[model samples]
Target: MTDALSDLARAHGVATAYTTDRGHRVDVTPDTLVAVLAACGVDAGTERAARAALEAHRSERAARLLPPCVLVRVPVGDGSGGRGASDRRAGRRGGPQDPGGTDTTPPLYLPEHTHAAVQLEHGGTVPLSPGLPPGHHTLHVRTPDGRQACAPLLAVPERLPAPARRTWGFLVQLYSVLSRRSWGMGDLGDLAELASWSGRELGAGFVQLGPLHAVEPGALPDPSPYRPSSRRFADPMHVRVEAVPEYAYLDASARPAVERLVERARQLNDSVLSGSSLIDREAVLDLKRRALRAVHDVPLSPGRAAAFAAYTEREGQGLTDHATWCALADVYGGAWRSWPAELRDPRSPAVARAREELAEAVDHHRWLAWITDEQLAAAQAAAVGAGMPVGLVHDLAVGVAPEGADAWALQRCLATGMSVGAPPDDFNPRGQDWGQPPWRPDALAAEGYRPFAELLRAGLRHAGALRVDHVMGLSRLWWVPEGRPPTEGTYVGYDRDAMLGVLALEAYRAGAGVIGEDLGTVEDGMREELAARGMLGTSVQRFEYLGGSTGRHGPLPPDQWRADCLATLTTHDLPTTAAWLSGEHVELRARLGLLTRPEAAEKAAAAAERDGWLAELARLGLLPDPGGEVAALHRFLRLTPARMLGVWLPDATGDRRPQNLPGTATVHPNWRLPVADARGRPVPLEELPRTALLRTLADVFADLEEESPHDPHDTDRAPDDTTENANANETEERHGRPGSC
Candidate 1:
């Protein structure tokens, strides 16, 4: 790349070159850099254009008296002044601070006799210097040179509060775990029951679920939860039909139609459980929508009507735009880009007229959003009430679908012609195009990050904690220009201080913990910065290797695990423990043409990795027999210092199939299978209490409670209600024991 182009790219926070995970350097082509710059609304097509853009950027910076925003990290205190006593505890004390409780940055460039003060968010004003409380405020400055400037100032907590003790929980893909009362898939009602039983009976401390964000409505919608239509709202399809309060008040005229819909939903559930059909999301959604329409027709009491009105008012314009998009989608389609030219812009006069024409439909979608929010709040309440310290840890998807609600509603904040993706890596030599647009850094700063702040606020509203997918995006993201290959993408950076400041402030206000999925292709110091904010990192068992350059690439020892992390045996995207032990995943991959290596070589490598863990477990005296391997692996997790441990829900029952297989879409049933046992028999929620495999695995993690006993309410052990070895024998008969490799 030419020097002029590189300078222009740097001015826009776009990288002309980057170092790969391997120890190699690759320079981005000049053409790629220009295209990416154009996506950021810069003109850099030629050397002359690039030089002009650079001059403009410099001139703009010199003319401005203050930056678009300022991030202030406050000091720790004892609840009276700053972060309080809880913030100084074991896992929460690494925030950026000097002796004076402020970060080290160059002094501001202003004329002499400059006056500065902060306009508090609520009411009054205070001096900009000295200690400022942790909240959002506005900074005002006036200089003797007759210049005045104002910007948004964010004063955030030094560190978030951590759990008082070590805790364990179940990690699940909610749609796969069904109950008898579910309408062909899991719902909020099922989540409540799962959390209540696990916390009260098995001593589990949390229930971390996959993202519940809304998906686009259509005859055939994308099934992956990671590519949501809107992250700000919960999916109404997950709402339990019977749990809505209005269901009980339905008039006689509306009763028979609802009854018929419920009966058909039961048939769908039975079909999935019997292995005759995969979970049909579209069909289930269709049934629920019809039944909900009947319930919506029921008259609400005065108090309930007032409550709904309050919710709509609090949500404000964001909710209205989302509901308007939904109403438009019903007439057109979910892809807003293809709508009529006049209606594409959300603020156009045509849209306002359309909203009036379809007022009832807009209200229906708004009502759906409100009802789903109520159910989510109820789920969190149920978990906390059942004695969980950290209940309902929710996941946040990295980005929304390009044709989805968020992309349409917030077009000004997103890059127009660039797709968020990854560069070429070892796992994917051709690289990957995720088909999601990234947030424009310049726009985020210009708007004072209101869109980003609102997104975080909504996610933490009903969560005890929130897990961020691809946390590395807070610093930088790869931008692939439209109609270009992923191999030609360049990295674009963001203001990390501002991004993290907004997150910390919002999470602090909600009293919620934060966890980041920093698993792959992470930048230097990203994990450390997250730790400084008291955010936990994720550690998967199979990916934790001991040595990098010493040629001793074995499984990391349990004792060497990091303390501030959520440790797990496997994740939804990877193979199950049982599949790993039996070499079934390798065979499945080979058959599906997803294997990059020879089948024999892949199998042999997988075996070596599995054996390494087995030897470690045996050495630690955690495994005694082949039948106990699954439990032993979980026992290995408990031996680590990780504060939070997550057991994949499918592992408890010896389910071998992954909920999602990343490479294949239609070839494999992704995100559509119900949770089943080793023999592929569906395991209902009510039946879980009597499963021997689940009971054995629970005992392994529950061993910690014997000494410390985190809960003081119970002094006696509950009677064993599980079946006596029958479930284990049946599993062994079908697939051999989990570890009998």
Candidate 2:
């Protein structure tokens, strides 16, 4: 451990905080042996054999950095190196779970060769069993007999199957869909009217929408839908432009000036649905860019101009260098990294003489990505014709805006001097960054994983379930780089077996279901290798916790969850759910001074405002106890059972507020506001089930009648490309009814 204290514990990037004078933490997280024996001036009792060689170089660096150590390349046995020192001391005294007593030299086992408890092995790459069935097999590691190790192709596990019960669902976010004919943002015709009102009314097995890619459209743009401008296209301000069927053959006397600009954009979406407020996305992209340039001057069909010139020649040259940098930012403007160097080369000849002096601004950004892919295939065919069963779900985001247009057309598989983020912990005690830019995991596995599998096959072609965001970035990603300070940054490891084998071969070729926003601070066994590959694991009911092994708690139920998850309570960067039951995120984090300790943040905000009014009087049974205040926090957040939940439509109308607020984005106003409606105002999704803030959020999911994991696409899409029309207000007589605490 003295290569200058293992290079000062690999320069402060592994601190799990040790030091009761060393080697005894069964509970891991001893801030990397007390910040590497407090940076080599040594202690841990005279560096207990340099803290047992810094716990055998952090147990051979968490078994060469964990995640079923990619099944230790299950190439059975080729002792290029591993399993030598006396059968790694007899599987380190035969594994009864080595509670930080420390081991692993030439060893790796889970339930022996993986049901994924944990393994980390790095190079010589073998790890077969993703459900194995490829070809030859065998991977024994020790007890002599000349050593067995063989492998041919490996991927057999019943030949990459699962994740396709119509790719599980539900995960909202497209600027919290302010619908009812949205123009003030929220489009693709209000995500095809919330997938035809979540498939008829909620048998909704799918509909996850956030990052409809394409952004930097201005009028207060940067509302951060993961800073786009071409994640292979879409964000034509969520194009609806009078629900373009080429605006019903225009020119009927130029249709009463586009019917008085669609009745002045339906009186500005009825003043943002009677002042629930905010919606003005540059006055709905200046009235749908004057109704899609007056219905693109009425002519296209020569087979829609050869399918928009074969989608501009199969989106060649990164959508023709981002439609020639939005036609040289409409006449040499908006920072093409501050243009003029051959107008920032989108294939220069001065960006092809500014695309032949702006061919109507590159045909209005290629007819705004063909009317945002014809309103995202008519909002996933109105969420599978509105009977529902997994209709939309899209998200994706995690990194993109180093001067957008997918960081200037995938700047050669990006990473330009780093910038991902998050390190200072105990939940952001400062460390955050998120300036966007990462992805050079060896130039996305030397582009074999074709630009992250063609941006996960263009968000599963109009998706019916995707979500991802930071699904622990497939496994490891802190990065930082660009002039450091996300606590001087580190953790870079990616290739989680070619990022979950390019997300199980693009959700098994785009039928679509993936999820992953696996919440914050994840490290140990990455939720058991994304639950042994069926990939679904986010919990959220305000961070559940009854202390581990998933039980003794309430919200932790739903069959200890992971059957390919979506389960929710609140996300779009937390807080809503009426500001987590009204202490208004503890008085907006103590009025943004972000409480360090003004008397333990005012006694943990007066005991979390008296346990949220005794969990709302134990959900109105008028609590035999909790008298002073503790409103049965939604009867203890609808007593667990989470396979899916996510109510946060501004916390189903109570709307306390918190789209985002990491570390004072200039005293806040982050992602600018708007989902309101119960007097705070902004409500729109066509006046939420005729408001009372969506009938007190459909009487709190009709008194938690359960069933919302929104099943179907647990990871690889297509349940029946949205089997169309069903939600005749479904909750099947208010959730599978059974009742209890």
Among these predictions, the greatest lDDT belongs to 1
Q: Tell me how many clashing residue pairs each candidate has.
A: 1, 95
lDDT of 1 at 305: 90
User: Candidate 1, residue 155: CA error in Å?
Assistant: 1.1
lDDT of 1 by residue, 454-567 (tens): 889889999889998888788888888889998999888887766787888888889889999877666656776777677888878876665421123666777666667899
**lDDT of candidate 1?**
0.79
Model 1 per-residue lDDT at 170: 92
Write one digit per residue (lDDT tens) for candidate 2, span 429-454. Answer: 34566777666543454344466666
lDDT of 2: 0.53
* Per-candidate TM-score against the hidden true structure: 0.91, 0.30
